[model samples]
Target chain A: MVPLYWYLWLGSVVFAVGIFGFLTRRNIIIMFLSIELMLNGVNISLVALSHYMQDLRGQILVFFVIAVAAAEAAIGLAIIIAMFRNKATLHADEIAEMKG
Target chain B: MVEWFFGYLAGAVILLSILVVLSRNPVHSVLWMLLMFLHVAGLYLLLNAEFLAATQVIVYAGAILVLFLFVVMLLNLKEELRIKRFTGGWPFRLLIAAGILIILKKVLDGFKVGFKGPWSIEAIEQATHTKALGKVLFTEYILPFEIASLILLVAIIGAVFLAKKRLRT
Candidate 1:
């Protein structure tokens, strides 16, 4: 059997990549995708811990996390659309009109 | 054998995720993200979370990705393509990346492993993942489940309100 630490290590690597992408990428959409990646990393660890502990709660929490992620994507994309309409730009740096 | 399979799946997930971040075209990023989600769902299946795997595919790969693509297309694609894909300040990004690595190292160093609970492998196999999940989710987590529904409803309303085109006065 694969040890639990391997999964946790994988999760941490993926989460680090997500953070890197989120901080470095200029496109707002890519940044949002990075956020999703970070969430997936968390989900992986949650499921791994669930399996390791032989508990159902972690998996249940994963379910809730997925639900919340969906909700977040919906609202976030809508907000992105609204921003695009107003600013006509996708670059995060250029969208700082309110940065007085 | 299963360990090798897990290794390959995990590696593919990390690779596709990097591609999702690095791809220049927004459309390509969305596609890469779709593949990454599928791989993640596969990992969930390996972990014996069958229902979560199915939901991951349906909700993330199917619905959320399509939504991303729609918004990608709706935006000014030509303009988006003309701009630089990455931001300036590599030193700062590198600093943050190093900080994250340090944090991960610290967390993993002290990580504990293996605590048995009610749902052992044999018990879960006998009861089946979906059934086992449903029992606990409906009973122990029913309140949070209902709250999740409320949150989804709010999200729907918020999306509609935010995306609707305003009328001229």
Candidate 2:
């Protein structure tokens, strides 16, 4: 078996990339995708810890995380669509108007 | 052999995640994200979380990615293709990411895995990952599970409300 640290390192790297994308990307959808990436990163670590600790709770937590992520994606996309309808753009900076 | 498999899976996941973030076109990013999701499921399998592996694929790749594609197509992003790809201060953001990575590395280095639960790999395999998870989820974690369902219900209503067309003169 691979050392647990390997999985931790991998998760951290992916999370860093997600943070980078979320901060640097201008598109709302891409930012959302980056958030998914970050969530997956945390999922990796959760499963890794589950394996290391011989526990099933970590996996159960991951299952719930996936459920929440789905809900978030649905509502987030709807908001994106609503924003696009009102402002006619998907760029985060351009969608900054208060009264829409 | 197991180590090699894990290395390949982890590398693929990292590479695909990078591609998902860096792809100029949102459609391409979605595709890369699909691949990344698969790799994450593979990692879950490696960790013996078969149920989560399957859920990851079915929920994320199957349902969520399709929704993303629908939104991408609905938006008609031809004008967006001509705009600048990234936000300003990207270099500083990259530096911040690096700093976060370093901090996480230090934290992980000092971390110790001390907990030894009743469920071992052999025990879980014998009971089956899905069965064990369902037993705990429906019994011990039932309240949170129900709350999760409620959250999803709220999300459904919110999505519909947000996307509904207004009736106007």
Candidate 3:
């Protein structure tokens, strides 16, 4: 049997990779996909814990998280499209209107 | 026996996620993400989450990544595809990611789980994971379910409104 901590470690590693992508990657779409990666990583840990602990709450939370992620993807991509329309660029560095 | 399988899935997940991050071409990144999502669903199946495994494939792979690919192709991002993969001082960002992982490890070392629930593996298997999940979702968590539907509703309207062409005002 695989130890549960291995799953936990995988979760954290995946999340960290997502963070690395989000921070370092300049492409807006990649940054957005990185957020999705982070969510998936967290879901991995939650499901592992829920399975080990014999709990349904974690799965429920994962369900809601997936739903919310779907919603977030719709809204986020729409915004990305709108931004690309206005700015004509996908580089996050160029769109510094929010920066001081 | 299972350890080897777990190792393969884990290694694939980690590697694909890294590739998703590092690939210069956005379409390649999306395809890599598709592979990573499948491996992750495999992990879910290993954990006795058949429903989530299915949902992961259907929702994430079928729906979400398709949205990403649609956007990637629709946007015609020819210029950004050829540029450097990261912004300036990317090494520092890598350090930051490593630091965060270290912190996560330290924090997880002290983690202790409490209070086991009644949904044992056998119980779930007897009732089936889907039935039990539906029972709890429709009964105890009905309110939140409604809220989630509302959230999706809002998302639908919002996405349409935001993406729709508007005349200059």
Using lDDT as the measure, what is the rank order of every candidate, best first? 3, 2, 1
Assess every candidate by TM-score. Answer: 0.96, 0.98, 0.97
What are the per-residue Cα lDDT tens digits for candidate 3 across B24-115? Answer: 98889999999999999999999999999999999999999999999999997788867888888889999999999999999888877777
Q: Supply fnat for every model shown.
A: 0.83, 0.91, 0.81
Error of 3 at B121 (Å): 0.7
The most accurate candidate by TM-score is: 2
DockQ of 2: 0.89
Instruction: Provide the lDDT at A2 for model 3.
Output: 84
Once superposed on the true structure, which residue ranges of model 3 sit more than 4 Å away at CA?
none
Cα lDDT tens digits, model 1, A18-64, are: 99899999898999999999999999999999998999999999889
User: TM-scores of the first chain across all predictions?
Assistant: 0.96, 0.95, 0.96
Model 2 per-residue lDDT tens digits across residues A1-100: 8999999999999999999999999999999999999999999999999999998888889878988999999999999998989889999998655756
lDDT of 2 by residue, B18-63 (tens): 9998899999999999999999999888888888889988999999
Question: Would you list the clashing residue pairs of candidate 1?
Answer: none
Candidate 1 residue spans exceeding 4 A from truth: none
Go through the candidates in order and give the C-alpha RMSD of each one to the true structure: 1.2, 1.4, 1.1
lDDT of 2 at A93: 90
Which parts of model 2 have CA positions greater than 4 angstroms off? none
TM-score of chain A taken by itself, candidate 3? 0.96
